[model samples]
Target chain A: MLTSCTNAIILTVNGDEHMLVVEPNELLINVLRNELGLTGSKYGCGTGQCGACTVLIDGEPALACVTLAVACDGKEIVTIEGIARPDGGLHPIQEEFLGENAVQCGFCTPGMILMAGDLLKRNPHPTEPEIRHHIKGNICRCTGYNGIVRAIQHAAARMAEPAAADGPDLVKEAR
Target chain B: MKLESYVRPAGLEEALAVLAAPGPKALVFAGGTDLVPMMRKMRMNGTLLNGDSPRVILDLSKLDELCGIRKAGGMLEIGAATTMGVIAADPSVKKLVPVLAAAAASVGSPLVRNRATLGGNLVTASPSADTAPALLAAGAVVRLAGAEGGPRELPLSEFFVAYRKTALQPGEIVTHVLVPLAGRPVAGRFEKVGLRNADAISVVCAACEIELEGSTCRAARIGLGAVAAVPVRALAVEAALLGREITADVAAECARLVHEHISPIDDVRASAQYRGWVAEAVVARMITDTAREAGA
Candidate 1:
């Protein structure tokens, strides 16, 4: 249990920073799930073997299990919930994931989200094999990889289209 | 371990001073994915778990002493702290050191690789360590910083004498790894035998590097992992492959030499006989793969 008696932890999540006095040995996953209540990331294996605990550390996906809360001091951490805009608009990846029905067990979704975000950041247009290979580190037991792959493609197609609004929302809101 | 006290030193010198202090128990933290769990599990070699553990936990991740990759002379000096993603994505590494790049890509997966360090791979020194054979096959060198001051260099081949053993003295720490550039990385292949397509520990792995001119082999080096107490080169295989034409018959003959040099043990991942057999096949594959590089 982290107490006020110990050192204060400073976390910059979703472009917002928070300070807390956490246990010296608290895990980043725990800090996010418990203290910050940013529980989008799931904990599958406390050991680093499983990618279920992955989160973006400085814009790169990192295993949250082995990462200590104190280690993240002065570092930026982005969780799955943080992917959406401040106005509650989903990032294209998340929207595509929902549109493609990519979520299953919901356990590995956060890790997959982080990994997919990482892939698109590095390569906007990745082949199926490349996408598979990129997310190979992430394990989804519910395993909607086919849907997940489609979601990525769907997201890519949507992103490829100009964002000037297409079908329903544009005309109705224009009035 | 329930870290008793965590101290993020202002610099490397302060960290080392804390580490070097007599009886001031400490564990260096980098990626912590391994150390933290092992400590948390109470299986850690030193330091107490969640109890009396360390007066301070030194986070080496802050130390810039071990990061990045750069062109150095004819070889590429990959900073020990450099992430696996950097290695896989680097154009120079992909073009020149494809084996290393591939091995990097093949490590635990993207998320794990992004945090795992090559220095940690060598320092941890597990027989099933995925990156060891690749480093050995590259004929890379490790630089260690010790209590004595200036850093020392050791060929990766001689670094690991046995399972979980390294030449580092009590206070020595691995600072960097120098992987030779491609086309000159000794012409090697890192073939791993594991349970899954990815994230599985190696069952029996081998990396073979050979320098062949036309039909004749010039120099040869073979590093086999998860077969013995330590990762070792199959000397008999090396001798058999060198100064000879690369052929299936010769490769078959070289493959059979596995029993003569390797000392595999039966374990959960595989049986002794199976490990030896996999070693043979892995070696054979390496020879053929190197043979295809006639144009490389």
Candidate 2:
């Protein structure tokens, strides 16, 4: 029989590796929010229904609420805090969300942005239905999803262009 | 949940040994989509500590042997720990069993599918499980490995004994699901009726695989979910379609026979009468679509 013991797990979060000891029952969201203080990923619902606690594990969008911290040992995690430009600028998706007025209460914004980023990475040019379908797991009470859908489409269009062709200034001017 | 220990076994043998051990209660952990929520509910209800013994979560996610998909000798062998996202996106699965792939794609949502495993879905034994009907229609079998014996295989039809119950014995873990590939060309379709398009549990679901010779049905397999205690095969419906020239009228007639075989119950998502109607409609649509695709 196995005995109760704290497990030392290694997690590479946003390119930084942290070696920490955690209890077996500790959830990934708890460790991230409470231990690391990466509060960008919200805890809207403890259940997996709400995608508010979504984070990218090995480049796939997974629910952190249901994921145990021990199971994520030695895996690379990218929370909403990690989803920015290298020079401390907002990502295209984030900019588009702002430009499109997708953020209402902002509770669902982080997860929505992360999910939109993951979707664009997989499919650079997604149709409107595909974009809506991809982000179906995320729930937004205020926006009614119209602004979010528009923002994702705009992000897809912006991301499809060459790096030098479009600048963040254009998004700022539009907003 | 109050898990005493989280054991990530390095190998399948070690996992089996841990499960076969006498004292502590070990719950097999895969994609935590189902078990974690259930555990949390149990914890909330203060039922997690019913027994004095400590609880261990035997995580099988790290085992590479349980996380792949391959084709061997006319069977698509999917590892038990293979995520639904992988299965849904797999090219091999799409080509061989498109219905299964579609069903996988229709499960919960992208976030849930990224971690939910095929074996976990079967072991949870939910009657509304999306993949169960598709796998049933494809005539899949599960390979089980226990500590005592080497390994054994059981048909997917026999895997579920009742509602929320499976034939999985203690100390035994599902290794892989083997879906037989049809030698001849076949057309299969899967349909799910839920309150919403995504992340909604099926009110009623159906899958149909039809092999046609000219205009006559050579072989047919129909599987239904959420219309019974367990995901079931509509054997009577299948038998009715065999050797018959499938048309709109004939499909409608056979779809009505599904009501005779299934016994659905009223749940939160739908009423029993609504499920019965939806089941017939879905089965009819599946039959007609599959037959058309099979060049009927």
Docking class of 1: acceptable
lDDT of 2 by residue, B38-137 (tens): 7776665534332323478899986899999998878889999999999999998898899989999999989999999999999888899999999999
lDDT of 1 by residue, B1-296 (tens): 34566777665566656667787566666767567776676545445432435645766765666777788876788877677777878887776666677677767777778788777777777787777777777778888876568888899988997678889776677877887664664566778789888687898877777787876888777777888877776778888877888887788798788777678888888899888888888888788877666522
For all predictions in the order shown, the interface RMSD in Å is 4.7, 2.7
Fraction of true contacts kept, per model?
A: 0.61, 0.63
**TM-score winner:** 2
What docking grade does candidate 2 earn?
Answer: medium
- Residue A174 of model 2, lDDT score: 39
Residue-level lDDT for A69 in candidate 2 = 90
Per-model C-alpha lDDT, please? Answer: 0.76, 0.88
lDDT of residue A64 for candidate 2: 91
Candidate 1 local lDDT, residue B134:
74
Chain A TM-score across all models, in listed order: 0.86, 0.92
lDDT of 2 by residue, A72-169 (tens): 88899999999787878788888888888899999899999999999898899999999999998998878559999999998888888877325756
